[model samples]
Target: MQYGFLYQFFFYLFGVIGVASAITFVTRKNPVAAALWLVNTMFCLAALYIMMDAQFVGAVQVLVYAGAIMVVFLFVVMLLNLGQPSAAADIKGTGARIAAGVAGLVLVAELLVLARQKLPPLLPDLPRGTNITVPITEPLFRQYLLPFELTSILLLVAIVGAVVLAKRRG
Candidate 1:
């Protein structure tokens, strides 16, 4: 299906915004600000997902990543008292910075090479229509039900542990 010029424009717009937000999120010194930037990145991703005809995925991206996950992260950040200046030193040493720069350059090169190459699909294509989640969700809720519940329990345990740590710190 051919989309209009406006649709293409907004798609690229959101993509750019998402990338910029992600960079800002990483470079932010304040953890709170960084988390907020991550939320912006997530919202931009949701927009891109919607534009790409994955409305359900977009909604899940916003609700799960942008909403629920971000809240939990922000909560943890607050509980850990990360907003204040700590005795710990930031990324010091020129050697580490240079290594990080090299790693970033290598990643960029890999991305450019991947962009030029046409990689075969990792999974088989499905029927084109809505209900895209049906295939994955069915297996997830059935075959993978035990693992899914276990993951949720793990997350709950982690949150409880964080709370305990915060209380101990206080």
Candidate 2:
């Protein structure tokens, strides 16, 4: 395939980004910074998914992992006051601010790239008019419905717990 090399290049690029971000996520002492790194890792994974022609999965990666999940995690972190910067924190106020600014710029750049690039599929002649989400949705809504609902309920419980904990502390 003519695009095989291009595909491979992006795969490795995003793969490296994902791994690096994951490592950064683990190493950061600041919860917010760690969460930002995790978000970056999610974006890289989404890019990799799109590269592999799983556009639906990629969109879900962005929308669910990067968007909804991160918001929830950040909400929990904030509620727990885990993002408060102390003098003893690995990144002090100035350093944390700098890191956040850089992360924001990088996020904007990555989103722009995602919006601008139109990638050719690795396989040239996939059948047209086939809805990509059908296979995924069928099992997800039918077989996994209970688990899905349970996960949502669990998240709701977690949010309520966090709120209770925060209220008690304050």
Candidate 3:
């Protein structure tokens, strides 16, 4: 059907864009550019998650990673006035090239092995409706209550430590 073909096309397109954006995130010299690329990459990943029928995950990916994290990164970059133009650095020296080549080979080998394995099929009778109605915080407070409280306590301690350190004078 036409819909199936369109879905497949978009799936591959978004996947390729995600990978390209990830590479750009790491390779871009400017911090702001890297953060922007990271946001783009997160958006692409959210698209991929939607294609896989995980609507909640996709929305959270955009809301948390792309929106919140990238906003914080951009704000910090702006506050610090990190507007320096990207300088071209030597990235293809022999040692660096060799290390990159080895990493690529390892990744390719892992992919090949995974491709050879047969994945289990999803249940045919499973619900197709996207469950986006439930708020994530509800489960965190109800089911994962203890862990959530502990994490908040840990974060508070970290914030207090940071403030104490910043206030110390010579």
RMSD of each: 3.8, 11.0, 3.6
Task: Per model, state how many residue pairs clash.
Answer: 0, 0, 0
lDDT of each: 0.86, 0.87, 0.83
Query: Candidate 2, residues 72-125: lDDT per residue as tens digits?
Result: 999988877878655574645788889988998999999999999988865453
Q: Of the pair 1 and 2, which is ahead by lDDT?
A: 2
Query: For residues 1-170, could you state the per-residue lDDT of candidate 3 as single tens digits?
Result: 23488899999999999999999888877888888899999999999987776677898899999988789879878877985644667256899889999999999999999999998866442265534545555787899999999999998998899779857486
Checking candidate 3 for backbone clashes, the offending pairs are none
In terms of lDDT, the poorest run of 10 residues in model 1 is 121-130
For residues 106-165, write the lDDT of model 1, one tens digit per residue.
Answer: 999999999899777555445577587786689899999999999999999999997787
Cα deviation of 81, candidate 3, in Å? 2.1
Per-model TM-score, in order, reads 0.73, 0.60, 0.76
**Candidate 3, superposed: residue stretches over 4 Å from native:** 1-3, 86-97, 124-130, 133-145, 161-170
Task: Highest lDDT: give the candidate number.
Answer: 2
lDDT of model 1 at position 18? 94
Sort all candidates by lDDT, best to worst. Answer: 2, 1, 3
